[model samples]
Target: MSTVAANAPGAAGGGLEDVAASEASLRRFLHGLPGVDAVGLEARAATLGTRSIKTTAKAYAIDLAISMIDLTTLEGADTHGKVRALCTKGRNPDPTDPSAPRVAAICVYPDMVATAKAALAGTDIQVASVATAFPAGRVALPVKLADTADAVAAGADEIDMVIDRGAFLSGRYLDVFNEIVAVKQACRRADGTAAHLKVIFETGELQTYDNVRRASWLGMLAGADFIKTSTGKVAVNATPPVTLLMLEAVRDFRQQTGVQIGVKPAGGIKTTKDAMKYLVMVNETLGDDWLSPHWFRFGASSLLNDLLMQRQKLTTGRYSGPDYVTVD
Candidate 1:
């Protein structure tokens, strides 16, 4: 029984724009939301992590996690050749086995988007670029928008933009909200369609589970297609409890607004077991609806190699090891 305007892209605090009309109103709306129960959230995530999957189920989860990966290469030394190679691995995580699933996208710096887009041609894989002064939102507003516009023009299918932690932490919620809204608009293309907008909160720096909840709501209200956990450049990127809290925010937001938003847990998720724990949480919290790559994504490089190794073990009953997998 929500009254959200169906056509209002910027509506969510009963109406997002109204909430952002003034910094005071935005603070009231965000703070009015119930506080997070940290102990309860952590216990639930821990319990879900221990849920054992049968062999057959683990195999299926492996493939599903593989398909949901945004095989990323965000190092300072990344070059065009490296990006093309990353795209090739994304197209086939297990080159010896065509039956293996391809990754959802090849995530790279904005400058590398066209190379990735060309390398991934003739495939359904998306080209996701990190923009808006990625990993840090310290730049000015126009700089962020121009960064987004360049990526979109270079053929990025998705734009991952980081929020200004300083603004959010200092209670400048409207500034953060407006930035997300503007970035979403900048994702537009010549065909009138827009690239998917994934807002990165860098949960490690947010300092509290409550802020994670608020950021989730704020991003959704600002027209974010997905709420990502991090940029993978921080000391602590994605953690189960933090990601679980984000999932709850999206679930509640969807219930009140009737709009579905995606969740991405980037950084530190470097193993198949870690990925499985997240998939379990998603299923238990949001059901099978959020299980698809269109609704969920893993922003990792090493995680994909581990998934492929585990897949090989399940199929051939032997370890493929790192030597056999891609160097990423």
Candidate 2:
């Protein structure tokens, strides 16, 4: 499958007509979706109450995707180091204590992917890059595909691409779907170790729960390995309610397709408590199968400090200084 042909506008084999039909089904499904009423809130609360403190914490360690706008900034360096340190195995400076959970990957821009990859070399941590004009995702198809290819060639283990939400919202659902399928196809490596594709829906821009659900299903059907929430570029990013909607979409998709796709709620996740809430949602909505790093991920830069603080409190029964535990 040549990248050019895969993304060509209205290329033969399957054209916009198929996408229009899929969109019609999606719209019908969305219109038929039940409203967010009191019953739904109660059920969600009940599910949250069942999660254990330990399981929630374990989920936190799975993956932390950090986005750095400027690699030269001190804040960016600090965030990167913290992620690298968390992914380290075995004992830290505190020999008596066991190492913390490994972070699945460190996310950054294309130029910085190599730096993160080098820092995380010889470890289980992966290097991920946001390609195809992230956040807005308004660029041309060929440009986006080439950007993805360049990032992967530079050692990015995972490629996070934003869907053309404008097209989907404007009723051009198939265009967005085909773009993702083509981008995923372009991620192949020389040795056949292709980079994983995470399709960002930017849920904040999607407006309604119905739209979110439809976009989730469309992305999965179009071959997205993971469906992520926001680009963190907007004021409102990942929220509990929106995440709840997306979780239901992935769960329902799994039932129908028998393929388990990953879910990442990125942007604006700040504290350990916030991360824990997401973990609770995943546990309740998706169950134990999607509990590991392979199935779930959190994308944030400030979240690591809070998680570490909470872990220290759990271990020593006292609050400790930032220096006591080294950040990556």
Regions of model 2 farther than 4 Å from truth: 1-98, 325-328
Residue 165 local lDDT, model 1: 97
22-127 per-residue lDDT for model 1 (tens digits): 8898789899999999999999999999998768999999999999999899989999999999999988788799999989989999999999999999999999
Q: What is the lDDT of residue 319 in candidate 1?
A: 96
TM-score of each: 0.96, 0.78
Every candidate's lDDT? 0.89, 0.67
Which is the leading candidate under TM-score?
1
Query: Given candidate 1, what's the lDDT at residue 131?
Result: 94
Runs of candidate 1 with Cα error greater than 4 angstroms are 1-9, 13-17
